[model samples]
Target: MTTNKSQDSLQQQLASLPQDVQPGRDLWQGIELAITQQPSATDKAKPKSWVYGAVAASILVPAVAVWISISSLSGPVEPGLDSAALIAQLSEQYESQKSSLLVTYQDKPALTDNWQSQLTELEDAAAAIKSALKHDPNNVALLRMLQTVYQQQIDLIERVHAPKWQQI
Candidate 1:
């Protein structure tokens, strides 16, 4: 049919065309010349400002974030109450209470044999938090965590030595 003949003719024409072709001149010379040239004054000045801005933002963004986080973590301290002094006061109170509780429970045996080990673990955790506090003394969350851990230790000591009926 005429359609088949036209298709064959098109395929023959495509096959007859040269497969390999070359430019009349070397194109790399122009590209090489362009790449080797220096940028104009406007282009140079524009990029410098943009680069400086990007560099400054890179440095400042993290600094601002750190400032915000530290401020928020420390929050607003009460008038005349320093974080370190408050921590020391609370620690002293906790120690006093813990010592008195231990003295009261010295004669009594704990209900569970592993209570001492559990207390040791809590003590270790408290020590780690205290170490962190030394670095970030004003962190309220760490202060609360230390208080909670101390309370847990006290509760553990009291509960372990309490009478069976009282436990219920």
Candidate 2:
């Protein structure tokens, strides 16, 4: 009975609220500016295909960071499957993807200088973990760290190379 009364009261309160609130007159000018600033239709549509990859990459960044931190505190997982082959595969993928991005972006300047620096930092971190893995052989934390860094490198490259419509 109490829930039924509360539901009815909630409905009445919602019905009493105004529904016609609107933006001020200045909002249309910004909308016009945005429309005018839009790039060509072809250019606008090109990035849509890669946008899913970009979205996935964005989501991965936080998960990797959290995983890295958690794994660093915990003792390394047991040596099980062959991490060497996995690291090698990720490294090869990174190299090919990096080269492709470099070729693609050869004519264009990066959106910012910070992305390359960030990639360098991640690369350095991956190298450090790789060096440690050489000693530990199958250290799960190191394997995960190396994979995350490599994945981040590819993601950054894709992001910088892709069409940047939002910049407008």
Candidate 3:
């Protein structure tokens, strides 16, 4: 067949071609000079790696020893004051002061608009958080929120009454 004859001729032509052809520019001299200019990186890294390991060990050994010593010397810390009772006592104080301030400022002109409304909002938030605490007595976050709202109520009461209202 013509296909088989053409395939055989192409193989014969490929076989007749030269195996190696020389490049016009010389390349060996630059390669030899570069090799002679420096030692292998692996050889240089051997001593450098040993020095780095020694430095790391020197720093880490003392730090680890100090940490172990300090940990062994300290006793366990004491737990803090009872948050529930503390909140209740502070709340009582704030309510007493707030009642007196309300009586004093009942007829006075407020410096800021809707200041009473702000106090009422804070009181509402505190009441809600306190009711939540009654249901979830051991909730830390609820206790913290109740304390924060109570403090806000006290601060609002003091601010609206004392400094500005006293001058008037």
User: What local lDDT does model 1 show for residue 44?
Assistant: 62
Write one digit per residue (lDDT tens) for candidate 3, span 1-168: 899999999999999999999989999999989988888777775555676677467535544543443343234422553435645764665566567557766886666788879988988898888788677655666655765676577567657655544531
Per-residue lDDT of 82-165 in model 1, one digit per residue for the tens?
A: 667656766776677778778878998888999999999998998999899889877788877887787788778878998546
**Top TM-score prediction, candidate number:** 1
Q: Which ranges in model 3 have alpha carbons more than 4 Å from their true place? A: 1-90, 104-108, 163-168
Sorted by TM-score, highest first, which candidate order results?
1, 2, 3
The TM-score measured for candidate 3 stands at 0.41
Better of 1 and 2 by TM-score: 1
Clashes of 2: 0
RMSD, each candidate, Å? 23.8, 10.6, 25.7
Query: Which residue pairs clash in candidate 2?
Result: none
Give the residue spans of candidate 2 off by over 4 A.
Answer: 1-82, 163-168
Candidate 1 stretches with Cα past 4 Å from truth are 1-75, 78-81
Worst 10 residues of 3 by lDDT: 69-78
